[model samples]
Every structure is written in C-alpha cells, then in structure tokens.
Target: MSVYQVLERWGIKNYRVIDKKAIEEITLGASILATGGGGDPEIGLLWTLGTLARGKDVVLIHPEDIPDEVVGASVGCLGAPIVLTEKPPSQNVLEKAFKQLSSYLNKDLEVVIPFECGGVNSTVAYAIAGELGIPVVDVDGMNRAFPELHQTSWVANGSHASPAVSVDDRGNMTIIDTKEDNIRAETIARSAAMAYGGISWKASYPLTGKEIKEKSILYSQSIAWEIGKAVKKARESHRDPIEEVMKKLKETREVDSFRVFNGKIVDIDRDFGGEATKGFSSGRIRMEGIGKYKNQIAEIDFQNEWLRLKVDGETLCLPPDLIAILDNETGEPIRTDIMKYGYRGSILLIPAQERMRTKRGLEIFGPSYFGYEEEYVPVEKIVSKKGCQK
Candidate 1:
C-alpha cells in the first residue's frame, strides 16, 4: 500500500515519520527526562531501531488531530528495570498484551499513547506503533516518568487504568478492573509483574481520542525530542550539555532549570530485597559535592523517578519536580538501573509540567504521596530560598 493510502485510511492529515536518526535523539532526551527512572535506554533503542530496520514506518500524530472515536491505549513495559535486564522480553510480549486487551475491550486498537517520556516506555510505545501499523500519539500521561502505574495525569483526571491487561514472557495473564480505583489497579498490576518474575508488558488506560486529550499530558514527545536535540547540538559544539538543557527550557517554556550540584557518586543505597522492594527500585543516593559546591554533601531519593534533592542538608527540590543526573560533560542521563559507583555527573532539576501540579496530581505524585512527611514545594521556590538563581 502507498503512504498516502495509509494516511487516508487512518484519517491522519498531520504526522511525522520516526526515522532512525530521530529515534536516537528522542531516546536520549526521553532517558534524561525519565529522571533516574524509566529503566534502560539501550534496550528500548535497540527495539525501536529493529522495527525501523524491518522497513516498517512508525508515524506520530498530534493528539488534537485524532478523531474522537479512534481507539487508544497506554502501553509499555511494567516491572523493575534491573529485573528486566535479567529477564529479557520475548518479541511477542507487547503484541500478546495488545491481543488480550483487544479481546477484552472488543475494539480494534489504532493508536498507542505513551504513559510518559521514559528511557523505555517512549520507544516501546513507538515500536508497538510500528508493529500494529498505527500512528503513535505525541502526547503522554506524565511529561516525565514516575514510579507507580497510578502516578499519571490520565488517572488523576478521572481516567482509570482498570480493565488493564498484563502479560508476561512465561505466558502468565491477568486482567485488572478495579472500577474507579486506579491505585488498586497499580498495586494489582505490580504484584502480577513481580509474580511473573519481575518484568511484564501491559496495555491499559484505554481511552478514545477525546478521553486522551482530556486526561493525558500534552506535547510530551516534541518536548523530549527538543531537549535531546539541544544536548546533541551542544555536544557537537563542545559546549556543556547542562547549559544546553537550560537554553531549551528558556527558549521553549520560559521555565528556569538549575544545576543543583556537581559531584561524584560515592554511595547509592538502592533498596534491593523482599516484598517491600519487589517490582520497584527505591533508595537514597549520597553524592560528595565537587567543583563549586565542594566539601559538602548532596543527597537524593528515588522510587523510579528522583524524588528529592538536598544540598548540604537543605531540601532543594521535591517530587512533581524532576531531578536528572547527567554525565556532566556528555549530557547523557545516568539511569537508576545502571549507575556505577564513582560515576561523575551533575544533578539538574526541572519543574514538573503545570498539568502535573494540579491538586489531584500533587496529591497523588507529590512528596506526601511518596511518603515524604512534608508539604509539596515547587522547585523554583525551593531554589530561590537557597539563594540560587530562579
């Protein structure tokens, strides 16, 4: 079939092709925006590139352009990132999930909306788009990645992840339909993942094009690509990638970002153990401050995404905000699943998208939601209180 025929059949008037080079840039930026969570970038990159190599065209469309009746679902890997590496997925993981969900929903799915811009989910969504011969929506649930399934704009805005289907490589299948209780859905899904040996693929948060627009975060794909492009351009010019990230924020959103600390990873207490830590990686990182913030200690916490940042014992950033640990010079993200001891990186913090700071969002993804016994504070306010540039 011709490309024109494909577009006409899908009623897509505006879209962009996901070429090889574009995927690379998108992967880089997505990983950085993942905020220390989102699993491994390499795994996602290889899968996406493989899809492209097979002569399948992955197309992306604007959310607004999608007709109200088109069927959409949020799809991606669901498990511990560290565990996923140990148990690599079979080619049919997501496809099987799609089939199961389609059977359950009794609708032919057309588009896959990403849950967030992450090292893994972003590309996996595109790979599924290619496999299913559908266009991937450019919008997402969380602008940045979060730990739990319910930590998304979709659920916060009255969408439910229930009627969710999870499938594993071992052929395990479980359907979740908690009926307006998305947290219960997440708990059940995470349990299914752990029981299936730590990595499973899922399809859920089923919505129409109209529900997606009402529930999901907006313009996430382009934002991630732009962030990645800025970092790549800076690298080619032999400039600091951190500054390039700041430049993009200023140019695009007028949002200020900051270099919270420059340091070498001295210790990371990544909680690796029994039921408490199963299906999720949670812990604290201690970085020995260097360069301008020399002779001081900087610390941060994580549960998928970086939750907090403290500089010399002062709380500098909080959840809903983002803390990205990047290779200070190369501008590459250092992920939670792969960071090594003694790795040198700069901790950069970006404010959460305005949509994520809404009352429901803050209540669900805020510090209190993460078990932090403190009021939610914006990164800008926290930075200014510390006498840092806003």
Candidate 2:
C-alpha cells in the first residue's frame, strides 16, 4: 500500500513523510543521543539514502494514531560497533530477520520500531519500513543506545524480546525464544553475533500498539528529528551547535543538559577478540583537560556505549543517563567505534528519559548493572551539586 493509503486505512491524520534530508538530520541527532554507540551513521545513512533513491516511501506515524491492536517489532543491528565499521551490513539482512520473526510470531507487523536510537539503528526501521510497505513508529525501546538486548524500556515495562530472530550476512539465522527471560535472550543473541564474525541484523521485541504507547519512549523519533534540525540550523547560522542542542532539548524534552568537560583524548584502552568481551567493544578512554578545564583529567568507560564518566576521580555520570563526546566545532558525536587519540570533544550529559528511570530500568541497565558499586544517581542531581557549566 502507498504511504497515504496506509495512513488513510489506519485512519491516522497526523503523519510525516521522511525524506533523505530528514533521515540525515535524524541520524545526526540520534548519533548524539546514542551516547557514543550505535555504530557509524554513514552505513545506515547510505542504506537509507539508497532506499529513498529507489522511490520508496518512508512514513512515520505516532503511536496514538494507530489502533490498540496494531502489531510491530524492532529491527536493528547487533554486535560490536567497531566490527560494524569493518563489515557493513549487506542489503536485505534485516529484511530476512523481519520476515523470520513475523513468521515465528504468526502475525503481520503493521509498523516498525527502532530497538534504540543511534546512527545505524535509528535508520534501520525507516529503511525496512520503506522496503516492506509498512509505516515506522515514532516510538523506540531506548531513546538512546545500549549495548545489550535486555536494556530497553520494553523489557523494563513488562514486554519480552522473546521469539526474536537474528540474521547474519551469509544467511545464517537464529530464532531466540527465551519467553520472558530477556537477559538470556541477550546472551544468546550476543553469542550468535560473535559466531557470525561480530555482527547480526535482528528483529525482535514484538508488541501491540497499546504496549508501545505504554511501555516505550514516546515521540522519540520526533525528538531526534528536532534535535537534528536544531543542529543543522545552528551550523547554517554560524551559531554554536552544542548550545543549540541544549536549547532544543529544553524546548522538546524539557530536560537539563550539561557540558561537563572539554578535553583532547589522550589514550584509549580497548579489549577486542577476548572471550570476556566477545560480541562487544569494551574499552576505557582518558582525556587531558583543555580550555577552562585545564589540568584536570576526564575518563569514560564503554561497552559499545559510554557507560560511565568521571572527572579527576569524581564520578559525574553513570549508566542509563547519557554521555556524548561531540566535536567542538560541528557537534557531531565522536562515536566509540571511530574514536581516536588527539580528537577534541566537549562532553555533554543529559538525564535519561523518565521511562528509563523506573525501578526495573535501574536493575537492568543502571550503574549497578554495569558493575559500578555506587547506586544510581540522576544526572541532574550530579550537575546541580557540582555546577557543571562552562
């Protein structure tokens, strides 16, 4: 069905047709929101752009616009972000996963949802939607990216990622149905990715429209779009993109954003091809203070995504909250997959969305889940206590 036909049949009045420019903007905003994970945007951008060039329609609809019974699932790439840079996904990888998951579920998906918001993952849903003639939902499991499959608003709010389907480029497929054990599903999925040479495209987390409205991050796609639009305008007008991002967040998300540090990367310690770190990019980065932060040091640890941030031995940001290292001049995210020494960036921190602050959310992806001994603390609290402004 055509995009208009789909919306009309569903009786949805408010919708947007995503163009190449919009996807590019969404990718940029989602890359920052990815908090240093989500792999590279270029891969997803190129795929999505190619889809658009083929005259396919990518329609985005709000959760409320659909019926309560409308079915959907998430589509994304899983594995080490760095490995994705080496082995870009082949065409039709996610399509195979989507089909397998739908067949396993015995239901036709009416829409596509992003597993997380990141560069490649953010665009995956749109590309698939365009391919399958389905609309893409503005909702997502995680407004930002996380490394593991279990870390999602869907799992935190009583949905399961069971009956998930993962596919590798060589046509190898695995259907993981852990029922309610999302953690086990995550482990199995990771193992599959490692076995497949480090990356797999996946379709999982089937949910109803009502479940999505209740359990997922609402309007997340729009949030990323607005952030991207704001940054684009800033670049065009010669204004500071980071400042523009903060303003846009205040307007759209009503959240406080902080610039916690300014520095140049001094060292990166990574573990690749290790059994303990298989299917993941585990690393720590150290930075030398610059500008007003002179003489101080900043450090961040990551498992595909930035998990913790500390400045001179004082912890400022923890898991579930957001940590983004962005270029000072362009505000483009300095992704962990492509980070290098001598790169300059300004650390930006934003509070995780309220949905991710639930008690179950903390248990799954918060500080303690990441092996931090400290309890979970809100980013706003840390910023207020320390005055994280420059």
Candidate 3:
C-alpha cells in the first residue's frame, strides 16, 4: 500500500515530511541525544542529502499504517565510532547489505525501520528507504541511543538481530546468521569491520510490519523532532535547553550540570586499543570541569556509550541511563573524538526510560556487562539522594 494510505489508516496527520532542512535539524537533535556515541552525522546527512539531490523522496510512515504482511528491516553502519570518523562509508554500502541479505533469504523487503534514533542510523534508514522506493517506518528499536547491538526493545521482547549482513567500502561482504546470540552477532560483525578497515555496513532485524508495530518504539521520529524543536527554542530565548529537554520528556530528576574547563581537549585514554578487547571501544575521560565547576574534576568511563560518571570519587551516574558532555557555549554535544582533557563543556545526566529497565534489559546492558561488581542503581535514585533530584 502507498504511504499516504497507511498514514490515513493510522490517523496520524502531524507527521513531518522530511525535506533537506528538516533532515538537518533532526540529525542535529539526534546527535545531541546520542550522548557521545552515535556515529558521525555528517556522513549520514551527506548521504541522505545526496539521495535527495538525486530527486528521490524519502517518505516516513507510521508503524500502524503498514500492512501486517510487509517485510521490514533496519540498515546502518556498525563498529567503532572512531573508525567511522576516519573512514567514510561507500555510497552503496547499505544497499549492498540489504540486497545480499534479501538474496540470501530469497525474500523481498517492503519497508525500512531505523534501529535507533541517532544521527547516522536515523538518516541512514531513510536514505535506504528512498533508494529502494520503500516506506520508512516512524519507529525504532531504541527511542534513545545505546551501545550494544542487542540493547534494544526488540531484543528485550525476544526478537533477534540475526541473519545480519555486513558490507565494507571496498564492496566486500559477510553474512552472519549461524550464531543466534546477539553478542556473538556483534562480535562477528566487529571482526568484519576490522577487516573492512574499521567500519562495516549492516542490515539487521528483518521483520514484518506486524512484528515492528508490536516490538518497535513507535513515533520515535516525532519524539526526536519535538526534542529538537524545544532545544532550538530554548537556545533562541537564552533558556536552559537541558531543562527544557527534561520538561518535555517529563523527567523530574535533577543532576549536576558541570561547567566546561578551557574549551579544548587535552587527553583521551582509549582502552582495548590493540584489538584484544574483541571489538569493544573502552575508554576513560578526565576534564577540568571549569567555569562554575572550575577547579573541580569530572571523570567518565565508557564501554561504547558513557557507562559511568564520577567527580572526585563521588559517583554521579551509572549505566542503563544517559550522561552527556556538551559544549557550554553552543549547547552542542561533545563526542569522544572531540573530547579532550582541557575541553570545556557542561555535563548532563538523565535517567533511562522504563522500557530499558525491565529484567531482560538490565541483564543485557546492566553494570555487570561492563565488569562493575556493584548492583545497578537508577540514575534518579542516585541523584535524588545527593539532592540533585528535587
């Protein structure tokens, strides 16, 4: 069915038709919410922009509007963000991955879903939809950014990311469906990325429209658009954008908003640098936390996404939640690549949604996954006890 018919069926009249300008704004907002973990937006944006320039229309459709029998999947780049920054993706990487996977399954896909609502992944899904003349679902696996492959509602509800296809800029491809485990799928994909010069193209979670409606986080694109709009408004009025974000998200918790040091990065410690860590990008960050927080210290450890936050040995935040270090002046988020010891930025902490706190969710992305012996503590509680949350 046509995308218009689907939208009509769902009674969703507020959906935004993504033109070039809207795409830019959405990508910027996604990068900020990514909390220093989603792959570079420039690559994803440029790819989508190029497709539009070629006269292709990238249409977004509500999940419920889709036909129950239509097959759908998500397409994006996976591997280290650092690697993606250094090596650009080939123009046809996602298409190649999709084609190979479909050929392997002897099935044709009718729609595309964004795996996460971040810069690269979000726009990449739309680009694929545009290229293939398929409708792009307005939902995703994770409403927010996450690190691991299986750290999504799809996996939490028992759906698999298997039968995934990975491709490289050089046109080399690898399909991994033999391993049913999500971590093992990630491991194999990571190794393929290493072999393909650190970044690998991927198409995963092949499912039907009915399965997507049941398992996916619907209307996530609308959420990102609303968050982006609120931030921009706050900036124009000289209001606190973070506060505005919290208010819009209905998040009542408060956390310390640390000040930026000197606005320049001085050092970064990337763990597992020699590939012994099995495709994981582990690292620690130390910043001066200057300005109002000047002379204070801010230390953060990350395994994919920011895992822990501390200031002079006092715990500020932990995993299964979100912590972001952003530019104090522009309110732009500072990623790991741009993060330095002398870099000046504000630190913001937010709690993870309840969807990510279920028993299965915790077991997949809890503190234990990161080698921490302590039990998982919700960010709200930690901040509340410290009086950060009022």
Model number with the top TM-score: 2
Which ranges in model 3 have alpha carbons more than 4 Å from their true place? 1-15, 251-267, 271-274, 291-295
lDDT of 3 at 231: 77
lDDT-better candidate, 2 vs 3: 2
Model 1 spans > 4 angstroms off: 1-6
Ranking by TM-score: 2, 1, 3
On residues 1-390, what C-alpha lDDT tens digit does candidate 2 reach at each position? 776787888888888999989999999999989999998888988998999999999999988887899889999988888789888988999999999899998898888988888889999889999999889999888899999998999989899988899999899999999999999999999899988998888999989989999999999999999999988998999999999889888899998899989999999999753468877889899999998999999999999999999999999999899999988888899988888999999999999999999999999999999899998889899889998872
Candidate 1: what lDDT? 0.85
Greater-TM-score candidate between 1 and 2: 2
lDDT of each: 0.85, 0.91, 0.74
Which 10 residues in a row give candidate 1 its minimum summed lDDT? Answer: 1-10
User: What's the count of clashing pairs in each model shown?
Assistant: 0, 0, 9
TM-score for all predictions?
Answer: 0.96, 0.98, 0.89
Clashing pairs in 1: none
